[model samples]
Target: MSRNAKINTLLLVLVAALAVLPLAFGLGDHKEEPFTGADAEAETAITEIDPDYEPWFSPLYEPPSGEIESALFALQAAVGAGVLTYYFGLRRGRRQGEARALARLRAEADADAGDEAASERRRV
Candidate 1:
C-alpha cells in the first residue's frame, strides 16, 4: 500500500527470482558436480592446467565430511549475519532516539517561547 512497502516487496521478489532462476533453468547441469564451491572449482582448474602443482599449505582443520564442512560454513555465515544485523539495528535505534530527543527539545523550546509571549501580553 505504502511507497516503502511496494519497494520492499519488489526487492524481495527480485531476490527470490535471482535465487530461483538458476535452479529452475538448470544452469549448472553441464558440470559434473553442480553447485560446488569456488575453492573446489579452482582446485580442479589448477590440476588440469598443471599436474605437478601443489598447495603452499593445507587447511589447519578439515571437516570429516562435506556435510560437516557445509554446516560449518553455514554457521559462520549465520554468525556474520547476526553480528551485522545487531550493529545495524543498534545504529538505527540510536538514530531514532536522537531524532526523538531533538524533536522533544524543539517542542519544549517552542512551548517556552509561547509561554513567554503570553506572559508579556498579560503584563502589558
Candidate 2:
C-alpha cells in the first residue's frame, strides 16, 4: 500500500480505539448519568456551590425533548462539516487548476522557443 493509505489506516484505527476504549473500560460507571454533556455537569456543579444562583440569560429556543435537542445538535454539526468540506474542496480544485495552467503555459513557451531556435538555424 501507499504511504498515504498506511497513514490513513493508522489514523482510523486510533480514532476507533479512542471511541471504544472509554466504553469498553466503563470509565463513567460511577456517574448517575453516564455520557451526559459537559453543560449538564457544569450546571450541577454550579447549583451545588450556590443554591440561589440563577442564569442571567436564557436560550432563544429550547427543544421540547432531549431527543430533539440531540438531533438539532447533530444537524448543526453536519451542516458545519459540510460547509468546511466544501470550502476546502473548492480551494484544492482551484489550486490544482492553477498548477495545470502554469504547466501548460511553461510547455507552450518551451515549444515556441524550440521552434524559433530551429527556424533561425535553418535560415543560417
Candidate 3:
C-alpha cells in the first residue's frame, strides 16, 4: 500500500483505540460527597469592608431585577454569543480564503497547461 494509505490506516486505528479505551476501562467519574460539618465560621469567611475607607465615587446606575444572578446570566449569554459568532465568522473567512487560493491555483495550472499545449503544437 501507498505511504498515505498507511498513514490514514494508522490514524484510523489511533482514533478507534481512543474511542474504545474509555469503554473498555469503565468511564472515569467523580462522586459528590454530602456536606459533613455545620460550619458557620467557614461559610461567613467572606471579605469585609474597612470602616476607615471612604467612598471614591457615587453610584450612578441602579442594577436590573434579581441583579446579582440575572445580570451574571445575561453577561454570560452575551459573552458566549459574541465569542461563538466571532469564532464561526473567523472560520468562515478562513474557508473563503482557502477556496480562493484553491481557485487561483487551479487557474494557474490551467494557464500553464494551455501554454504547454500551444508549445507542443508549435513544435509539431
Candidate 1 global TM-score:
0.68
- Clash totals, every prediction: 0, 0, 0
- For candidate 2, write residues 14-114 as lDDT tens digits: 99999999999999899898888899899999999998999999999899998998899999999999999999999999999999999999999999999
- The alpha-carbon deviation from the true structure for residue 112 of candidate 3, after best TM-score superposition, in angstroms, is 0.4
Candidate no. 2 TM-score: 0.69
Off by over 4 Å in 3: 1-73
Q: Per-residue lDDT tens digits of candidate 1, residues 34-115?
A: 8888987888999999999988898898899989988999999999999999999999999999999999999999999999
Q: Locate the minimum summed-lDDT window of 10 residues in model 2.
A: 31-40
Of candidate 1, the 10-residue stretch with the lowest lDDT total is 33-42
Compare the candidates by lDDT and give the number of the best one: 2
Error of 1 at 14 (Å): 3.0
lDDT of each: 0.96, 0.96, 0.77
By the lDDT metric, which is better: model 1 or model 3? 1
